[model samples]
Target: MLGQALLMALRALRLNLLRSLLTMLGIVIGVASVVTVLAIGSGAQSQVTRQIRAIGANVLMINPGAARQGGLRLKAGTRATLTEGDVDAILEQVPQVRAAAGSIAGSAQAVRENRNWNTTVNGTTTNHFVVRDWTLSSGRTFNATEEAMAGKVAVLGSVVARELFGTDDPVGAEIRVMNVPFEVVGVLSPKGPDQDDVAFVPLSTAKLRFLGSAGGTARDAVAYILAKAVSDEAMARAKASIEDLLRQRHRIQDDQEDDFKVQDPSAAAEAQRGATRTVAILLTSIAGVSLLVGGISIMNIMIVSVTERTREIGIRRALGARGRDIRLQFLCESLVLCLAGGLVGVVLGATISLTVARSAGWTTVIDPSAVAVAVGFSAITGLFFGLYPAHRAARLDPVEALKAE
Candidate 1:
C-alpha cells in the first residue's frame, strides 16, 4: 500500500518534471553548502594535527629572547642570545626532562668535486638524532671522541645527497665546506623537504673549523635546545620547571615577562584544534543562513504546487478520499523532491572536496557523518516547509475547488 502511494507520488513528479526540479533547487544548494564547508574545515584541522604529530607529541621549545632590550633595542636579524649552558641547565635541573640536545644553524654552500649546492649547516651533537627519532642509513654519527677533537666530518640531509651525488652512495664521500674538505660520514633518511635541506656536523667542528673560531664563531653560541618530557602527564611540569629555571637564571624581575619563550606541542595542538573547531562552527552557521533561505523557497514552491493540484485533490476527495490522505500525498511529494535533491547534493559536495584536495593540494577528509546530517536536514526542511501548504489543501471545499477548475 505504501509502495503504491510512493509510485503514485513519483508519477506526479514526472508529470511536472520542471516544477519538481525548480522546487528542489533550494534543497540542492542548502545540502551542498553544508557539506563543502564542513569538509574543508575538517581537512584543515586534520592537516594541522598531522604536522604537529610529526614534530612529536608533548614537545616544547624555549626560543631566545624577544627582540627587545633596555636602551639597546636589537633590530631584526640580530643573533640569538640563547646559549649551550641554558640547555645544559634545563637537562640537569628540570625534573621531568628525559632527553635534551642543543643546536645551531648557519647557511653555507656545500661542494663535492664539480657539484655545488646551497644548504643550511646545522651544528649539534649525537643525541639530536635520538631525541628527534632520526635514522642514519650508512656510516655512523660522530662519537664523543670525534666531537671533542672537533673532526672535520659531516652528515648529508636527503636532498643534499640527491643534489650532490645523484644515485651514487654518498657515505665516505668528501664534501667541502666553503672549499674546506670534510668527510661525509652518513646520510639521514628522507624526513620531508623542510628537514632535508640541510647538512649536519658537530657543534665544535662547525664553529671552530668552518665558522672561523675555536671558542664559537663571533664569540656567540647558537644552541637551540630540544627536550622531550619523561611522559605525557609530566609535560606541563617539565615546561613549568624549565620556565622558572630560565627566569631565575636570567634574573628576570617578577614584574617583567621572561625573555625566553617555551612552546609545548601537545598544548599547541589542543589550542589549534580548538581554533579550528570554532572556525568550523562559524562557517557552518553562515551556511545555515543559506539553508534557511532554501527552506523559504521550498515553502513558496509547495504553496504554488498545492494550488495547481487542487483539482486533483477535489477529485480524490469526491471519490471518498479523506482530507488526511490528500495531505499525506502532498507531503510525500515534497519529501521526495527534497530527498532526491539531498542525495545529489551529497555527490556534488564530495566531488567538490576531492577536486579541491587534488588541485589546491589541500588535505580533504570527508566526514560520512556530515552526509547523513545534510540529507536528514533536507528531508526535515521538505516536511517543515510542506506542512502549511498540505494543511491548506486538506481543508479545501471539494465542490468549490471543482467548480473553480
Candidate 2:
C-alpha cells in the first residue's frame, strides 16, 4: 500500500516537474544558507582555538591601567605602573604561577650589510620564552652571562630571517638594530605570519640601547608582564593572587580601582566563539523563515493537486480505497518534495562554502550534523504544512467528487 502511494506521488510530481521545482526553491535556499553559515562559524572557532593553544595554555597577560599626569590621562600601557619588581613579586607570592616574565616592545630597523628590514623589537628575559612556549629553530638563546652583561645579541623570527638572509642561516651573523650592531645568537621557529615579523633581544640590551632612560620613577617600568600557571586549573588562582599582591604593593584602598589589568587568554577565545555562535544563530533563524515559506508553498500546491485529481480520487474510493490511503499518498508526495529540495540544498551549500573559502583564503569546516539537521527540519516542515491539505482531500465525498468535472 505504501509503495503504491509513493509511486502515485512520484508520478504526480513528474507530471508537473517545473512547478515542483519552483515550489522547492525556498527550502533549497534556506537549507543552503544554514549550511554555509554553520561551516564558516565552525572554521572561525577552530582557528581561534588553535591560535590560543599555540600561544600556550593557562597564560595571563598583565598591563598597567591609565596614567594620570597633571590631571590628564595617558594611554593604558603608557602608564608604566608595572616594573620588573612586579614580576618578581608575582613569582614569589603566586604559588600557582609556573613562570613569569616582563617584556618591552619598540619598532626598529634592522640591517645586515646591504639588506635591511623593519620589524618589531621585543625586550625580554629568558623566562619570556618559557611563558610564551617559544623555542629556537637553530643556534641558541642568550646565556646567563650574555643576559646579565646586557650583551649585544639578538634572535630573529622566521620572517625577519627570510627578509634579511633569504634562506641563509641567520645564526652566527651580525645584524644592526637602529645602526647598533648585534650578533644573531638564535632563530626562532615560525609561529605565524603576523607573529613571525619580529626580533628578540635581551631586556637589558633593549633598555640600554633602544628605550634609553625615561627619567624619574618610571625608569624601570616594563610594557607588560606575562605569566603562566602551573596547570590549566590553576589559572584563576594565579590571576587572583597576582592581582591581590599588586594591589597591596601599590597600596590601593578598597574604595579605589585597580591600577593594573589582568587578562586570561582563554577568555578572549571563548568570547570569540560566543560571538560566532550568536551570528550563526541569527543567520540560521532567518533561513528558517524561508523554510516556513517553502512549506506553505508546498501546501498550496498540494491543495491544487487534490482539487484537480478529485475525479481520480473518487474513482479510487469507488474501487474501495480508504480515506487513510488517500491521505498517505498526499503525505508521501510532500515528504518526497521536501527531501529532494534538502538534498539539492546540501550540495549547493557545500559548493558555495568551498568557493568562498578558496577565494577569500578562509578556513571552512562543514559539519555533517548541520546537513542532517537541515534535511530533517525540511521533512518536518513538509509533514506539518501538508497535514491539513491531506485531511481535506481525505474528507471529500466520493459521490460529490465524481459529480465534479
Off by over 4 Å in 1: 67-72, 75-80, 112-116, 135-142, 165-174, 180-191, 211-220, 251-257, 318-325, 351-362, 391-401
Off by over 4 Å in 2: 1-11, 213-219, 253-256, 314-328, 351-364, 387-403
lDDT by candidate, in order shown: 0.80, 0.89
Model 1, 1-405: lDDT tens per residue? 456657877998999899788877777877887898889888988877766655665667767654656668564324365667777888889879877777777789999889989999888888777666678877788889878888888888899999999999999999998877889999998777777888999888877777633224344465456788888899889989998998888788999976667878667777888898898898888767766777778788778878887888889889998888878877887788889989988888888889999999887888989989999988988888878988888999999878656
- Model 1 residue 168 lDDT score: 91
User: CA shift at 323, candidate 1, in angstroms?
Assistant: 5.1
Q: What is the lDDT of residue 31 in candidate 2?
A: 89
Candidate 2 per-residue lDDT, tens place, 278-297, comes to 99899999989999999999
Give the top-scoring candidate (lDDT): 2
340: Cα error in model 1, Å:
3.0
TM-score of each: 0.83, 0.85
Name the top TM-score candidate.
2
